[model samples]
Target: MIADARRAVVRAGVAIGIGMGGFVDGILFHQILQIHNMLSARIPPDTLVGAKVNMVWDGVFHAFVWGVTALGVALLWRARGGSARVPGRMFGGALLLGWGSFNLIEGVIDHHLLALHHVVERLGPSVWDWVFLVSGVALAATGWMLTRQIDS
Candidate 1:
């Protein structure tokens, strides 16, 4: 029925929004910031011998992140019962907020304090990295708050 269709669309939109937030984190940090890639594994510089090995692992890691995000979206869709619910929204938001917070803290500790990587290496990386993290947290908090409103 038309109502069902509308519900389905709404649910899908919520899932997509959350998933897109995750995708943006991965893309901006892994690609644009160039601080780190999706994978935890590190790749040696291209000047190093066997650099190709690192490249291969990097590609695999990025693919894994993409797959995980897709799976998460699918799971959210199922859990929300074709409709966005308070619990689902809150939980998803919390999860993403945690992830962003972790990244922000870790990046500061490892890259800034530890000097493992420059804050801006060749270009300005830290600025956008923080922005991405903050945006993610905001989205998650909004989702959580929306979930609460629906619940009440």
Candidate 2:
């Protein structure tokens, strides 16, 4: 049987992964880099007013990321009452899984299906998007393999 501690650790890892991933996307692409906004691809937030609109979307996105982080912390806190020993591999693998899963699902649904945004806006469904998806697959696969090697 999988101990609650292990389960909690995995969940916590996933949460952290998701939160970190979101922050990476938001900070690297959205704010610091300013390569793309949440709706820049769709709405083309070029003007001051448009940028304000995109900022709102960005804020919403950050809020969601914050929530993911909070959930992860809660999971970790719960684990404190349990066995307290969580395998490093399990946690690491779960982190990769969660982050990769986010990229894969978000890329497919938002970029491809919903036409929300692309990895590179000016490129317009170029190689960068595929690279993003492939990277996610690679990370997730590696993580899954690592987890499988362990006894869960």
The most accurate candidate by TM-score is: 2
Give the worst 10-residue stretch by lDDT in candidate 2: 79-88
lDDT of each: 0.49, 0.81
- Model 2, position 15, has a per-residue lDDT of 85
The residue-by-residue lDDT of candidate 2 on 1-152, one tens digit each, is 26666677778988888887888889998898787788877788788888999899999999998999899888877775655566778878888988888788877877788877788777777787788889789878887777666654
Cα error, candidate 1, residue 100 (Å): 4.0
Model 1: weakest 10-residue lDDT segment is 37-46
- Candidate 1 residue lDDT tens string, 1-152: 24444344335444455445445644675567655532223333444543455446557755655665576567556655654442544454445544544445545654455543433444434575466456546755655454344322
Clashing pairs in 2: none
